[model samples]
Target: MRIKILSIAFAALIVAAAFTFIRKEVKVDVKSSQIAWVGEKVTGQHNGTVNIKSGALDVENGTIKGGEFTIDMTSIDVLDLEGDSKGKLMGHLKSDDFFSVEKYPTALFKINSVSESKQADATHFISGELTIKGITNKITFPATVTVNGDKVNAKATFALDRTKWNVRYGSGSFFDGLGDKMIYDDFKLSVNLSSL
Candidate 1:
């Protein structure tokens, strides 16, 4: 009986040590991360960028177990326009008709799960809850993630329906007779992240 008890305790210690070795928490390098946005209308398309405020990732056995990131919505910048034309668009985007950056200056995404991707080019499928303008919604996208030593790099591109998050504005679904003034409901976001 004594020998059996000792063996059981040894097994428990081994399991605990293995678990500690497999799981890790890493801080995100917000300065090195980038999130680009693209919005289209019947007339043309506009592209810009937003900053990542902070983030962290849970890595387990070289795979991302979970992660969360905060976006600085007030950092939205238009790259295609210059002078007042750019200023006007930026003002409108921050107003209540769009992201309402004054009321909600930051957006957040928290990962709920991650799974190996079946896509040839993608590494994993990440499911998470995205909160914008005080509204939270579930979003899933494929990402290419790599881990080397203490560093991690990830990239993902996905489109989100603005209407689902109550970003109505000139959306054709909410307003008729918009014609060319109507902005498409879906907007694309491309994210690149690196670990500190």
Candidate 2:
């Protein structure tokens, strides 16, 4: 009877250990995280910052299993201009000619899968569905992710074709006879996130 009781206790300990290694959810520190964007045209380029509304990451044994984030489209700010110039550009970007922030105030990205990266600097390749202006598209990019104690940090930079989400304001692909006014279809986004 003594030996049987000891075996049962050992089994319970093993089960507890297994539970510790299960997936854990970490809430993102939105105030500390940042997302920057850059859009270029034939004449010049404009860069600005956007805010992450909320997010969380799923981690298991130091590996990121999944994650998702929401972007506040109404928080877009232009960094390269000042005063009226900045406000004008920001207003234009949030209008129907661009993101139409009044109708779709937020965007989202949900991770579908993650894999070990072949790049020397990046730690993983993240494949996910990105939704903007109410349209969702699959995008894959390399990211550097670090997990330490109860914290996680991830950084990545990638470019997406704006036309994919139907933001076709001054795009040459849709309009004609505009030489220097054509805005490039692809815009770049740089993301840095920290989880609490």
Candidate 3:
């Protein structure tokens, strides 16, 4: 009887280990070159990619595995703000009046809760924290993910207020005699992530 009971327990342990070994993890594909911020005829591009980082996950019943999506902010864009007058514009953008890249050069987003409302399309509502210019804010956005075999793709769009980060240069401080138009208050980001 003792031998039979030990054999059953050993079998159960093997099954549990196999299940853990086959568990899926969340993956990310970073394409930093795909980010841009354009306004008032000013546009900037990044070097290399945006760090395009990823993190661990827990998959439950084919769901997200866990309720977390994290990113590394040090992987953010360092705009190539140099080229003729446009280069000067980029310099201005990086100055203390604008992005203050010297002090705050990274932007971060971390998803805390992800809820699935549909099964066929795999639509999700992800809520997370966004940090910029040393300020942390909570934001919730929509992400649509499609899975095929071991590959996955997710895309989303969101906006942020430049003023919130103290990026106030040329925003409204323009001299009237110089006669300059103030840039808009909001900045938008479009993201498409693919994982394997």
Candidate 4:
């Protein structure tokens, strides 16, 4: 009878240790990480960078369990243009017709779940809520997650519909006969996140 009680106690200890390993959490390095954005029009495309204000990752035995990050929308920049054109385009992007940065200065992304990916090139399949201009939507994408000692690197490329967040400036769905002036609804974002 005493041996049976000892066996049960040892099994409980093993299970507790396993749970402890799965509860590790890490904070992301906002300065070292970045989110690059691409916006396309019928005539051309523009690319730029946005700053990550803050973020953190919940890691379970070196696998990403969940995470969240905030974007500083007011820090948006235009990399493909220069001089007056750059300033003008930046202004328009922050205006009421676009993000309205003054009114909505930040965007947010929160991970709902993450699963280990079976693909060769990807490490994780992540599903999350992306909020822009106070509108939230679910986005799922595959990312390459690399863990080296204490450092973690995560990268992903995905697209989001600007109209869904109420940024409909030249959306073809809202306007007709725009010809070359119609901007595409989806914009691409390439994210590279580094965290300890």
Candidate 5:
């Protein structure tokens, strides 16, 4: 009777261990990660970087489950210009004509879902809500996500229409006859994020 009881207890312990999940929440390396952006008009374009304020990622059994990030809108940089020109553009971006960063100094992104991709180049597809200047929109994009014990690296290139978020300055969609001075509605972002 004792031997039978011991065998049953050992079997139950094995079953419980098998059902245990391996999951972790990792904070992103804000200084090492970057978000690059590009805005274009008919004649040319401006490119810059925005700083990430804070972020964290959830991993389930070595797969990216979800994450959320906050961006410092006041940290916008116009990389191509120099001196006063850079300052002017940066100021304009922060003003009401553009992002109104003084009023809304932060933008946020919350991941809703992540799925493994069938393609070789991209590791996963992501769907999330991106909030800019206090407006939130659902955006979906593909990313290359890699996981190595305790570390995660993710990269993606995606486009967002500024007008969708009520940023209508120089946009032809709202005003006509702008000709060459019209700015395109779509702005691009290249994101690279690292978390541990």
Candidate 6:
């Protein structure tokens, strides 16, 4: 009876230890910038940083199980605003027309699957549920991961259509009225993440 009890206790300890090793905190960095034409002969680049909260990376056996990620939308800032007036662009972007910062303040990318990419450099492909403006979509992004000790590096580029998440204002046929020829629906995203 004592031996049986000891066996169970030992097994439980092993399981607990394995679980602990599976998940760890992570940090992700975002340096994506964009150039938008404000008017004739005028353009500016929008820049921002993504700060994550309570991020965790998990591994089961030899495969990555999942990771939880969030982006800090409050950090968004546009550079080179035409003249000293920058409030207009910032206010409009944070309004319900674009990201609706008041209602949906942050964007999230919760992991659903991880796979090995067929790229020559042994890249990793991650599929996750991306939530923006209260809409979630399962999207895939190609990440080139490099393991250095306890750290993991992931870099990739992706695009998002604002209209998909109900951000349909200031777009479409009104293109002719707008300063630019036509506001492009496709917005680019670039990520450079280093996690432990």
- Top-scoring candidate (TM-score): 5
Off by over 4 Å in 5: none
**Residue-level lDDT tens digits of model 3 in 90-120:** 5666667665667776666666777875644
lDDT of each: 0.94, 0.95, 0.58, 0.90, 0.94, 0.65
How much is the lDDT of residue 162 in candidate 5? 96
**Evaluation by TM-score, superior candidate among 1 and 5:** 5
For model 3, the superposed segments whose C-alpha errors exceed 4 Å read 1-24, 31-33, 38-61, 65-82, 117-122, 170-180
lDDT for model 3 comes to 0.58
- For 47-102, candidate 6 gives per-residue lDDT tens digits of 43344543555655545668877766665566556544567877777788778888
Overlapping backbone residue pairs in candidate 4 total 0
True-vs-predicted CA distance for residue 140, candidate 4, Å: 0.5
**Models sorted by TM-score, best on top:** 5, 2, 1, 4, 6, 3
Candidate 1, poorest ten consecutive residues by summed lDDT? 15-24
Stretches off by above 4 angstroms in model 1 are 1-21
Write down the TM-score for model 2: 0.93
Error of 4 at 178 (Å): 1.2
What is the Å distance of residue 24 in model 3 from its true position? 4.6
Candidate 6 backbone collisions, by pair: none
RMSD of 6: 5.6
Give the alpha carbon lDDT tens digit for every residue of 90-162 in model 1.
9999999999999999999999999989898899999999999989999999999898967999999999999
Best by lDDT: 2
TM agreement with the true structure for every prediction: 0.92, 0.93, 0.63, 0.90, 0.95, 0.70
